[model samples]
Target: MKIPVIGRRDDTADTPDHPATDPIEELRAQLRRVCGGRLRTLDAEREHLDARRRGEAARMRRVGE
Candidate 1:
């Protein structure tokens, strides 16, 4: 004798009318947006510091000569 299971549905099934969105992908996209902004800010700050360092080096070289 076979017994049918009730209140059970397949979560991975997708229909043509509506597509299922993966929660993992959504979280990854949000993380990328946040990390991308932080990376850009850090890059700008590094460039500014490098420029200042170069200016100081040039001044030291002129003083030594």
Candidate 2:
């Protein structure tokens, strides 16, 4: 028999005061947390690449001059 794993505390029947927690909501929260870090890292990478591109362009111009 496969046991169902409930990811959120609100999914429990005992928590009447809380709205029923959706498994997808728990997943979305985790996804957002994980992707947030990835986004920051990508942003930093983009900035670095842009700066490198600019530096390369400047160097080429200097060489041409």
Candidate 3:
């Protein structure tokens, strides 16, 4: 008895239209996206906290006067 092939027989599977990709690069790109989002959130939070601190300081000065 003869067995039949089950998968692609030519190297055209990795054609120019669908080139192969590096796993490490893909992970790095994903990490950059996540870190960028987190950085933006942290920056916004810092700005908000700084504003609150300044307001509180101003209120304290008024009380002292």
Query: Which structure among the candidates has the greatest lDDT?
Result: 2
**Sort by TM-score, top down from the best:** 2, 3, 1
Write candidate 3's Cα lDDT for 20-61 as tens digits. Answer: 445554455556676883433578879989999999999999
In angstroms, the error of model 1 at 61 is 0.1
The sequence of per-residue lDDT tens digits that candidate 1 reaches over residues 1-65 is: 22212333245336664345465554555566768834335788799899999999999999999
Candidate 2 lDDT over 1-65, as tens digits, reads 22225563524435665455578765665566768834335789899899999999999999999
Could you tell me every candidate's TM-score relative to the true structure? 0.39, 0.40, 0.39
**Cα lDDT listed for each candidate:** 0.60, 0.65, 0.61
What is candidate 2's TM-score against the reference?
0.40
Q: Which stretches of candidate 1 lie over 4 Å from their true place?
A: 1-40
Model 1 Cα shift for residue 45 (angstroms): 0.3
Give the winner by TM-score: 1 or 3.
3
Point out the worst 10-residue segment of candidate 2 by lDDT: 1-10
